[model samples]
Target: MTRSPATPLPPPKARRRLRETAALTQTQLADRVGVTPGTVRAWESGRTTPRGRKREAYAKLLKTLAEEAAVQAPEPEPKPKLEPESRPQPQPEAKPQPEPEPKVEPEGKPQPQPDSQPQPQPVAAPEPVALTPAQAFDALYAFSAPALVRQTFLLTGRREQARESVERAFQTAWEHWPEVARDRDPVGWVRATAYEYALSPWQRLRPRHRHPEPPPADPGDRTLLNALLRLPPRHRRTLVLYDGVGLDLPETAAETEASTPATANRLLRAREAVAGRLPALADPQVLHRRLAELASNERLRAAEPPTVRRGGERRARLRTRAAIAFTVALVATTALTVRTAPTHYEPPVSPGQAVRGVPQRVAPGALSDEELELRQKLLDQMQDGPERLSPRLE
Candidate 1:
């Protein structure tokens, strides 16, 4: 007869769970397994594995505990099902019945009879058509670009930069259409990109942006914009995402790449700054409304999809060309350095002194017979040049 295979032990974590589920302590399990408590701890932590008779005993105990745990595990709630969909209802048995005598109709009246026919089945709805990449990109851009631009405006407080930021972000999305389309939230992807670009630290280095743009005509709006610009970038981003964009704290933390507590700290500080500047606008709801109004009131507009796609293609081509050029230049520079570099060191030649000056040497005039003849011939050729070569075409 063939022997049965030995049962394998569960994982380290599962071992601890099995022990706990059985209401057994490490020491108790150690005694049952014929080992010390430290050995049990090591086994549970995956630091060591039991062997020989000990291994079989431990496995057997774990198996029993696992069975108990399975018995104690709660079952999932049952799903409600439709009778027609889930299965056909049980039909009642047919029985013989006494036939009633037909009544005679008076003067040209016809008797009615019941119709025997099965009801028609319900038809399922047709599946929706999947979108092409270009079409999907167009839809995403048309839906989100305008509002994304406005949100970026709130972040940077610049109408021109906000429009630029949104356009750049959309262009980036078009370039990576496959990845963006597969993303769970394409809108969020574009929004995050636009927000980061709009608030980039390098943007401050531009000469035109050295000073703040002209303030809004409304004093209230001007105060709010100034207050937002005054706060640090992280604090402002957290506040805008949490309050302005209506994102929950966890989402805001995730997008900002900060811990929940840190994000909360930033939001609190930002609100205090804005509230300090404008006392009447202390409530977060009011602030959110004001930010929306300020963004909507601007004349910001996005370029069309075709324009954005072309721009993205152009930018990509430019980058590719630049990379090629840089590589060629680097190769050329390396070749030149290698060719011109001295392989061996040489002592410098000392300048010859007068040595009480032997009479200064003189040479003949620069124009030799061949040089004079060549110079004369060139002059004659210029004088006899064709009229087409004349300075005046006429």
Candidate 2:
């Protein structure tokens, strides 16, 4: 019997390690392979695998890249040998110094005793748990979901929208759990994703159902939250990322998709707007404290696990209906306005003018004094009176 070809390497681990070794981001690798970033992510996360020509191409590309990397790697330089003159020399033995004698204390004077050695403080070790992919996702969800939902709520004034955005973001994280688990700042990644999702323009177009009113909060907090919602979305998001989420300026800028200077300007303008609404916010410490309290409250709330089945189809259907309704209403309004609008600038004609298709003018010489006086009065009325001229009969 013919021997079977050697089994292929596991694609997921090989693809991830190869991409890392080549210092290529998922986006970069996707670009090189002429595929979408999501496809690469799915492949790395084991959600899907490359097949047929694509598989062969992927394996070939990785092998070529690994070879190029190995060839381009720099050789290690050899260490220099030490010379006899540079080596440490042995020294002749020296005589030991005499110990100083302690003086005796005088009679009736108390002698000083040596201090007792301080005991070492015990250090608490971190819990050691090996995180499988599922466990890691669970831990991240437990830690970050509530806070992310709250952050999204502050960004989008609607509580339901905020919850939806957070859920979608977390669902994405779960899809790419392997990569997210290996990320340096998984929480930050999820938070940023949720923030972007909350701010998506498509979300604004979707028809929203009414939600139950929230429980009573501090009047001051309500005032501040209302003011925050009134702010431009960019400014509000920037402020929340910096103050509420405690991200540094650069991180906030990155999340907001703004330059550092622009982000700084937004933050400054947001602060001023808030201060204008709430005088207490003029004090930086007071502003910071309030934001911290809001964040703490959000963190303390319970979080539900994200829905396993994403609501993409439902949202898409709703969006389509909304678009159709908007279009129909827009067309109807335009038609109504056009139909009712005044079509011509000229006033209605008298019977004589209608028959002649022109206005009949009287000569000054043909007019009686009364008629002339009446015409002059009409002219004066036209120039100064508030009442408009009415059409006359012939």
Candidate 3:
């Protein structure tokens, strides 16, 4: 059976009236509607409209309250009034209509005829207004941050890393706002940054991340996520951007900084690896579906737009302070270099050290008197007699 469309909700003011007349507080209404008090408030205040089953339930509830109000407050009885007698009046005559006449021309002068065809007027396009850095940052963050957080989470199955990656990307974007804002695809710029941060080899070394995060509750999800994680980093990224994020081949290649064929190869290998584990996901569509479901099912939500913008600004300010401090340090180092530099030419100091470990030999004494006499006798013997050739037979 086809389900009828949900009843449209009443105006915000009338909706509030219905709730008030029904003596229901926002909390009470929210409880009955299966939503939060804040959602109910937003509904009544017209900040947002309720959707799906919630919308049906809310519409039915308001309709019931209105009907009840109508029943309880009956209409008042009609009152009688005095009627006055009246008389008839006069009639009038029709007048002749004036017609458009052709103009008369003087002899020998040429008469100009009106153009039968209508000319089209050119329309000036409205000028595009430029956004300030903060506004642009907020806009970009709002558009891409949530999906990015999820994408990062898929890339590295860690929630904290996912959030941190996006925030860091936006921070970097804001830090280099001029370049980023000027980029043809700022979202792509931010996404690339976030992806790089998320996929950094160093992130795996984080103390908290050393142990794998808890897997999805569903066995299939757990298996799929494990399969995704098992792929090489490059392959996994290509798969996520290609299948999960629905990016085309060339765009995925561009984002991954690889040639199209290389990206295709990585994707093929990644899918094969994933399919090896989950044979049902061998088809690309099924793989994409599973990847999306895995990412979506996680309890991932990014910070509000303002919070992200504020964080980006905070990071930008920190970078500015760091640059200023670095400049000051550089200036100080330069001054110290100038002050302590050698005043004049100087010989280079030798760095060589005496060789170690070998024994130092003592030169023979010039003479103890006996030793000198012995030495003189030996010298005389060598000069006069044949050299004393052998040590005594020892």
lDDT of 3 by residue, 143-163 (tens): 888888988988888898899
lDDT of each: 0.83, 0.73, 0.82
Angstrom error at residue 247, model 2? 1.3
lDDT of 1: 0.83
lDDT of 3: 0.82
Per-residue CA lDDT of candidate 1, range 1-394, in tens?
Answer: 9966666878665787688678787789889989987788777655468877888999999988888889999988999877776787799999989887556688756577676698999999999999887788888889999988878877888888989999998999888888778666688778878888888989988886977677788887787888888999999889889888898885676567554578899999999999998987789889889988887777888889888888999999999999999999999999999999999998899998758758878877788899999998787774756556447566
lDDT of 2 by residue, 160-229 (tens): 7777777777777776677777666788778878877888888756657334436327776677778888
| Residue pairs clashing, model 1 | none
**Better candidate number, 2 or 3, judged by TM-score:** 3
lDDT, residue 290, candidate 2: 86
User: What is the alpha-carbon lDDT of model 2 when measured against the actual structure?
Assistant: 0.73
Q: Among these predicted structures, which one has the highest lDDT?
A: 1
The alpha-carbon RMSD values of the candidates against the true structure, listed in the order shown, are: 23.9, 28.1, 29.3
